[model samples]
Target: METLFRICFFMAMMRFSAAEELKRNLNGVVGGNVTFPDPVLELGFLLGGRGTIALVNDRKLQIVEEIYTNKLNWNRNSGLFTITDLQKNDSGVYKVDSKKARVFYISYNLTVYDGAPTPAVETLTVSSDSCWLLCSVDKATSLLWYKDQEVQNQNSSASSLPITVHKEDRDSSYRCVAANPAENKTLHVNVRTACGFNETESGDNPKQRAYWSVIPAAIALIIGALVVWRVKRRLSEKRQTEDYAEVQINNENPQDGTFATSAESSDHFDSTVYSKLKLPEVTSAEPDLQATPT
Candidate 1:
């Protein structure tokens, strides 16, 4: 009875070892290459079960299956398998067995997806107080929302999620993670202060406010320069007119030892005018005759 129990126990151990399944998950692009991990070679160790020769998908390596005829490659030293130009139809369970022991050495479950789509964020609605944003993808098994690289929503499991943006969150950055069992994609959105918010009443960041202030500041500087130039021009013209009036007054008063030449007054005269004055003339001989007679 003891010997029988030992044989039963050995058979149970064998059954348990045969029932063990090794799970491996892998992803590949539509037309990309994928390789299965190779089992480590130990000096005296056998993987999955004791074996001498390796068999793939229950077929001898020498006799390649039709599905893997030209697409499969194997490395003898590493015990690794590579498939080139992966197709959607090639996604399934791959098994490697030991020919001598007739037990599985390793099994791999591979799932191939077409490709991960690029995620995009869109603005749906905007109000004075808040804004609504949406992140979408063509197809996804789950969706994740992030704000500033931290997870925001953990319960979202759809292709799209609506994100609420408050006035205080103007400068916050949002991200979306769309994923499936095969692949995942991430997209980001930067929220600016001008997204339907009241920018004049304290909704902008320092940089944005400074940027907007530059426009008015530049306009003010230009206007000030124009005003200064106009005032200077007016003053210069007034000074020139005053000088001209002083010159005319000097010219009109002949008693002042200043005289205006015809060349200088030609520009101001419509036509030339003439003035006459007379003075008495005396002889010195009358005084000498009177003194000699006296």
Candidate 2:
């Protein structure tokens, strides 16, 4: 099944053109004149916003793009063409009309892969000549390339994974990618620190030393203040306790030589003393005698 699909895949790859009035949808996409309900076919085109592909007069046209490196112009023997990065510019209709195969041929539909890969140089160390770089792509593809960011020393391979690069190529930021001949797909590899290239540490040594010294000094001052506060509190508490005790002692202790004595007096004031006097003693007797005479 896969073989038949591949066989039909390379047969035709139509391009966008104004001469052919291709169907906007997939009804006109898979094109072959073969009459086969069982013949498998696989056709791949770069996917994008431009889904429109045509097969009339054969002058393929797409919006001009920078990294588009491959031209899978549909022809008689170009069985299958892989449009690497299905780009936004590739969106439109795709139509194929080939008379090579017979008995019901089913062509595949559009699959777009228009994302960029991340590629980078990992290490530029080991004498600058033996440095090795590691690149990773965001979008995976079978076609990989090692590109020097500067000087344009580029190498290609069939790998969508990490590709090892040399050190002399390290001068430029290098990246890994998965690309197709059509150059419709594009991705860059991620990059990081390189070996052998020494970057200066951020701060000055003297400045770092100064900062460290001040931290210890500040810590010492804080500790000293805390100790002094504790000692002063202890001393103040002791003094207060001593003063309170002294006041209590002073209040209980006998002072100077003063004495307070109570006197028992014989001379007393009586309220009935005047009535019991000798002159008043005869009054009662006189009143009684006058009453008897009356």
Candidate 3:
């Protein structure tokens, strides 16, 4: 009797092992789809903690649950079942049973998660020769920073990760990744722009900044030259005016308009008039002297 009891216990353990062997695991993200393995002579499909959700009769699929009417699909040609637009609440153990000569069962453990959010990068601090960056995200299981193709830093449980880059690598490509078991999102970073040493800065591309800096100096030089030219022009004009004045003074006639030349006097003789005054002199003195003598 003890041997028979041991034999029964061994058979039960084997059965448990067989059942465990039929179980599979699956993962899906929100707004994504998952497909189950094909089944032959499928009888019914069940969800753990719930009643039957679907059945197959005469090779035709029929969904008994109204909740899965639009979300579930069964392919008759391939005998495959697919679920679309999965949600977090849809994660559970799913079972499908079939009957050929005897009953066969397969179960899938499905896990649905929210899609990982896209990572956001921020410049935390910047030194003269190095820069610190932070990568942050939500609803993600892991965050990582990559410089080129190499991993620079990573965190599995944290939502944020930090990394430092040198000035020499400012132009190198970098990416931030936020990931879950089901999906991942990546953000590309322009290292030069993110580190505040972009092409517009004099330190990064000296030619570009130099090109702009030279404009003001060039403009100033042009203005200075213009001012000098204007001053020289004014001085030249003043000198010319002085020389013209000297020439005019040296060549000006001395005679007034009232004074007539010989030609004019001859032409206007008829219209000319003259006046003169004379005084008596020696005859009066002689008469006085003679009177004295007499």
Candidate 4:
């Protein structure tokens, strides 16, 4: 009878080993579809009998036996375990025990990542050495600057991992990719910014602050040239008046109303009677100088 009982126990042990022989394979954590990856993937183990399946990561062990809330549980004689809605945080090795004569172990690694940030927008109208660049991304993990598919650098103005970006490269069509490293989640973003002013091609490019300098110089030069011209014109007019006076004082005769060769004849001539002359009336300190030529 004892031998028979031992034989029955051995048979039971063999059956249990055969049922749990399906070896577990580690899932790829980097890339591939995780069907319903929104929730972290649940990993359970086969306890064989009425035992339990559990996982240990960072010294924390989470057991699975009953369908408790968001976790998957198992019943007696169950050999399959599950993981749900997995993220990068769910990475680590999980252990399972059948409480019998078999213990299975598998290692799983999780990864997560994010895309770049979105760029701001504005209006700019300019050309030449100055080109416009743009940047825009939403919920992105990393931002890589590029020009014609060539990865550029982020400059000193920013404080992100992607270092070296230029201020002048703003109006460009920027791209961003967001991802969850643990869940292998990924997304794309496109951004744009208005082009700004560029002085690279102007024929007479001048300093912006010096624009006011030319204005004062032009005004002063114009005023000085005008004063010099007025003085010269007055001098010419005086010389011409003196020449005409000398001729009149040398010869003229108003009595015959004709030119003469002697100064005495010019002295007796009436200057006011020749030209259409009108003189101002006398004042207290001024005389009416319109008397006869003599």
Candidate 5:
């Protein structure tokens, strides 16, 4: 009776141990590495098993279906199994058994998926004193907002979420996380001061610098053109005044008339006029006196 009771106790203990399953949930990206850590202690005596037959002191790991032959590797000492270049077909339940008990010991639930899309963040001003940060992604199940790597909002389940930015957060970096069952993606942006948008590290804008530089040059060119025009005008007026003064000086001299002729021609014309007018007056007077005497 005592032997039968001992047998029943052993079976019950085995059933209890088998009912306690060690479940591990893990995620793996496509074309990446994933490792299933052994839950058994290093010093624990665990014999490898195959079906109902137990291999005595068998330390070699026995994969159930041999589904992954080329990509799987195992460490006997640590009882760790690693798979490289993970594919979608690798997603499923992986079981490790204890050889001494011929029962499953550890089970790993792995999920493999393609990478998630990176989120895009933008800033908008709702009012003069209020601002909103918008985060967006394609096919995202949820959205999270972060300030300086610290989580600000985590309850968002939409692809897009809007967060209000405060005055104190202007100098802090804002981040957005877009997540799904496959993976998580993040993007960040630096916020500016309360008065304006974020400036470059040098505290200057290239376009503004270019505009300022061009302004001075344009003003200088305009001033130079004005100075050149004034100089030309002054020179022209001075030349006109000099010509007028020369004309006035010439007019002040009495010998500088327009119709004045040469001296020799005037004297010859006066002598001819006097000879014609004197005629034979003297000869006539002498003849009258001689007839009276006869």
Candidate 6:
């Protein structure tokens, strides 16, 4: 009967010890630091399952693992343990055990991840009234779109998400966030600039609208002036060629019967001139011949 009582007492003590242990979830980033909230009072810090990494006994700190030689630190006053330059493989269950067993045991499930990349915002389409935007990130755990400070949309398992913004809200702020459990990155955006619109929110003002229109108007005038100048130059050259041909035709001697000019050439000139010559009469030719015979 005494042996049965001893077994019952031992089982009760084991149940009490197991009930005192608590667990928590924590996250960390690669190359970054994390502090375990468990305050150390002569405690042993172990990694994974029963692998001692650090210990604080008799007010002296001892680092047992070679990997955590300089990376782990213990604060006596604050009684906190910190690890720096975390790696992805460092993610696991971390246990802190009290030497005297007076304090409850606490274990942390630490998850370490690489740094999150900043999301890129793309303008898909824009009209006079609204703009369509898309946000993209690589290997992100989640993507979020924010208008000002409020989240407008989010996707947990997708690499990209889309949002529609109205032109009336063009003056408001916008951003995209790519995040994992351990890290997050944000990218700010200006809707007006992203949508390729140069007009301001006060674009309805007549003076301001005209101010923006002046540049394009000036460019159009310059292009028109150049076209007109080129056309006039071509017409002037044609007129000069026609005038030269007329001068050459007028210089020819018409009496030589060498008017080798074509009809096409004469039609080019305004008018043409002609010269006529008459022979003297020879009525008394026969009388001269009779006198010579006598």
Best by lDDT: 6
lDDT of 2 by residue, 1-294 (tens): 999887676554332232233433321112212111121123322323344332222334342333444533333344433343345444343334333443222333343333334343344334433444444444454444446544233335433243454444444555444454323244443332344432222233455667778999999999999999999999989666544311112222235322333223223323222211121223333344445454
Full-model lDDT for every candidate? 0.63, 0.39, 0.76, 0.41, 0.62, 0.78
True lDDT of residue 267, candidate 2: 34
Q: Model 5 RMSD to the real structure?
A: 11.5
Assess candidate 5 and give its lDDT.
Answer: 0.62
lDDT of 5 by residue, 27-121 (tens): 89898888767533232222223331111134554333454556666666665667778888877776544434444467668899877767887
- In candidate 5 the C-alpha lDDT for residue 224 amounts to 100
What is candidate 3's CA lDDT for residue 91?
A: 96
Q: TM-score for all predictions?
A: 0.58, 0.27, 0.64, 0.28, 0.55, 0.62
Q: Cα deviation of 271 in candidate 2 (Å)?
A: 45
Candidate 4: stretches off by over 4 Å:
1-63, 66-82, 86-91, 95-105, 111-127, 132-141, 154-173, 178-180, 183-193, 196-294
- Candidate 6 TM-score versus the reference: 0.62
Give the top-scoring candidate (TM-score): 3
Question: For each candidate, how many residue pairs have backbone atoms clashing (under 3 Å)?
Answer: 0, 47, 0, 48, 2, 0
TM-score of 4: 0.28
Give per-residue CA lDDT, model 1, range 1-294, as digits (tens).
999999999998787576556566777767777877843322212222123222344222443355556776666567566777889887776655444444444666767787766778888987777888887777755787888868877434566777787877766777788776666788777666325564533534465777888999999999999999999999989766644422222356565445553223334557544332222445456444445454
Cα lDDT of candidate 6 equals 0.78
- CA RMSD for every model? 9.8, 22.6, 10.1, 16.1, 11.5, 11.6
lDDT for model 4:
0.41
Q: What are the per-residue Cα lDDT tens digits for candidate 6 across 247-285?
A: 124335655544343332334576654332333545555
Preferred candidate (TM-score higher): 2 or 4: 4
List residue ranges in candidate 2 displaced over 4 A: 1-133, 136-148, 151-154, 160-174, 184-221, 224-228, 247-294
Q: Please write out the lDDT profile of model 3 over residues 1-294, one tens digit for every residue.
A: 999999999998898679756888888999999988846454555455487778887888888889999998887777778889999999998876666543457789999988888888899998777889999876546888898999989888777898998888876889998888888889998878788776435655877878889999999999999999999999989665544211112223334213222222333245643322222334433344445444
Q: Which ten residues in a row have the lowest lDDT in candidate 4?
A: 32-41
